[model samples]
Target: MATNTTTKKPAAAALAETAEARPERATRRAPAVVGPPLGEGQEPVTVTLSHHHRIDGTDYTPGAEITVSPDYARGLRGQGFVART
Candidate 1:
């Protein structure tokens, strides 16, 4: 039997030519999904907040303050945030 002298084989050559291609993106994605979109005049409110303040580490009150979107403060309401007076 004759020994194969070719170091570059078809399989090895194809493997060398293969490359990982990435698709080009058109436009940038919108903001990360903070939550669902609000109505014409509404905002988003983060429900189920943490009692302990991450800033001061103090036990805050439920009625004292709550995190909400600016639009929500106007009229937009999140999934479960309720407008308070």
Candidate 2:
């Protein structure tokens, strides 16, 4: 039997990809169509809550929806919240 293998990017590459995709890097600083600019320096951030059928390492089910500000999300990003998927 033959084994299949493929080259994978490192964790740093994943992080870089995420950083590149951040809203802060928008090419044009356009105005927001709904309620102030998303993630603007001033004003509270808004996020939609979603319930997923599954989650990792957590005993809760079906899942939980949480709304967090951009500021709060930054903290969560470092604490494995972004890894939940």
Candidate 3:
């Protein structure tokens, strides 16, 4: 008669081996947009808000007067949300 024996690896060791066999993925990110600096060579203008609104994740109450770049103020004025003074 003959006897046979087998050995098993521990769970932690098996998991570590599996992890080591896989390659890691590189993280991806959005490309940055290049443009002129804010209010560059442009005069700042003050505008009054017509109603409560959120701009660039910030909230502004109605009748709030804010100083912003001329280009930004023009866009807000066109939308009737602000009146440039």
Candidate 4:
């Protein structure tokens, strides 16, 4: 009595060899900035809200001192937020 069965490689070639041994991971979009960034003659600058923020409704607690502009303070300093120069 002997039994041996091995045959599995049809799932799109095992997902293309696990996506080529995996090593791409570099997709992190979502930084295009929105409205209410002190438009109309723009010239605000001075940003420093490393955390809490609101906007139009106004809140901006965390280290607040906002005054956004300059392309929304460079899109809130690329999200990490930290501008004052």
Residue range with the least summed lDDT across 10 consecutive positions in model 4: 29-38
* Runs off by more than 4 Å, candidate 2: 1-62, 83-85
Estimated TM-score for each candidate: 0.23, 0.26, 0.50, 0.29
Error of 1 at 20 (Å): 3.6
Worst 10 residues of 3 by lDDT: 28-37
What lDDT tens digits, residue by residue, belong to model 1 across residues 1-85?
9998987659866765663344555795423223335556655554333233232233434443544455643332333334344
- Candidate scoring better on lDDT of 1 and 2: 2
Off by over 4 Å in 4: 1-7, 10-44, 54-67, 70-85
**Residue-wise C-alpha lDDT for candidate 3, range 1-85, written one tens digit per residue:** 8766777899999999999998888785312211222554676667789978776556778997777777877777788887445
Per residue, candidate 4 scores C-alpha lDDT tens digits across 1-85 of: 9776987679999999999999999996422333354667877666677777676555666776655568877777788756344
Candidate No. with top TM-score: 3
- List CA RMSD, all candidates: 11.4, 16.5, 10.5, 9.1
What are the lDDT figures for the candidates, one per model?
0.43, 0.46, 0.69, 0.67
TM-score result, candidate 2: 0.26
Cα displacement (Å) at residue 2, model 2: 95
Candidate achieving the largest lDDT: 3
Clashes of each: 5, 0, 0, 0
lDDT per residue (tens digit) for residues 6-77 in model 2:
778899999999988876855843223222233655444433322332223332222334344566656545
Instruction: Assess candidate 3 and give its TM-score to the true structure.
Output: 0.50
- Per-residue error for 78 in candidate 2, Å, reads 1.0
